[model samples]
Target: MKIYIVGSVGSGKTTLARKVSAKLQVPHFETDNFVWTRHLKGDIRNEIEVRDQLLQDAIILDHWVIEGVHKDWTDPGLQVADQIIFLDFPSQKRVQRIVKRYIYQLLRIEKANYKPTFSMFLRMFKWNKYFEEQMKPEFIMKCNVYDHKLYRFQTDKEVKDWFHQIQRG
Candidate 1:
């Protein structure tokens, strides 16, 4: 099974993807890995061609879960996904989660795959706002194209229930 999870930052896309990956014994791919290159200079985004190639490699897997906050760049995965999970958690809850996660990363309590910085923390809030104000409506509209494969959840409880149902099946 191939799954694609899309949502705003801190909407639990990564968390849900990890859980599904563990339960299904499938590899989980994060768009951040393809988008950002770790370097001493800074975290630089890969060229579009490079990012596309990396994403193509992951999605071609027999079974996998790919999760990200990216929309346009994720279209390939969306096209191929057997199931698309849209985490539609409230903005307030998402903001809270982002703050908590930022704190954990800052305190070194959580090991972040990417470098944690105050600027990045600030950007998270901006990104969240941008998502709510701009990207969300566009996303919803785009998702209609894949309505048959879409499974949207507005709460963590709903997400958990859906995950459990998938596990049972």
Candidate 2:
């Protein structure tokens, strides 16, 4: 039951992955953990060796979930996944979520690999631009090419119901 969850920034990919993974009692892999450098301001590590090792390990496991918005790092995981979950919410909703989450993280002193800096929000505000320029045409194209069984969810309740259905079935 390998699952690969892909979504836009602040669409709750990590939250959903963690919940679903726990429900299914499977290992959960966050793409940030795969590509992030230990140092705070270092470059993202997308080396073949690092990602390859993670993919190899995940393949050997019977059940695992990988979640992220990274296309290059996620491509290898997608190859081995039995299910794909795409969270495509409204741009406005996504922006609200991002802003709220960013505020909460800042208040709590929680660190996110891709922190919500002012510059990031400025770029993210152009919702159509993000989908058009980054995620939709490129990352989604690859997913379509592979013919992955993708589950698209719009609302939080729908996502929960889908997980329950998966659990019961």
Top candidate (TM-score): 1
lDDT of 1 by residue, 1-169 (tens): 9999999998998888999999999999999989988777678989999999999999999999999988787899999999999999999999999999999998999778877888889999999999999999999999999999999999878998989998997
- lDDT string for model 2 (1-169, tens) is 9988988876888888988889898999887677665566655776868876876677678899888777775576777788889888777788888788778777776566666577766665674357746777676677776664878788988888888898896
Model 2 has a clash total of 0
* Candidate 2: Cα lDDT at 93: 81
What TM-score would candidate 1 get against the native?
0.95
Model 1 gets an lDDT of 0.92
Clash totals, every prediction: 0, 0
TM-score of each: 0.95, 0.81
Best by lDDT: 1
Give the range where candidate 2 is weakest over 10 consecutive residues by summed lDDT.
124-133
**Superposition-based RMSD of candidate 2 using all C-alpha atoms, in angstroms:** 2.8
Q: Which runs of model 2 end up more than 4 angstroms from their true locations?
A: 40-46, 109-128, 145-148
TM-score, cand. 2 vs. native: 0.81
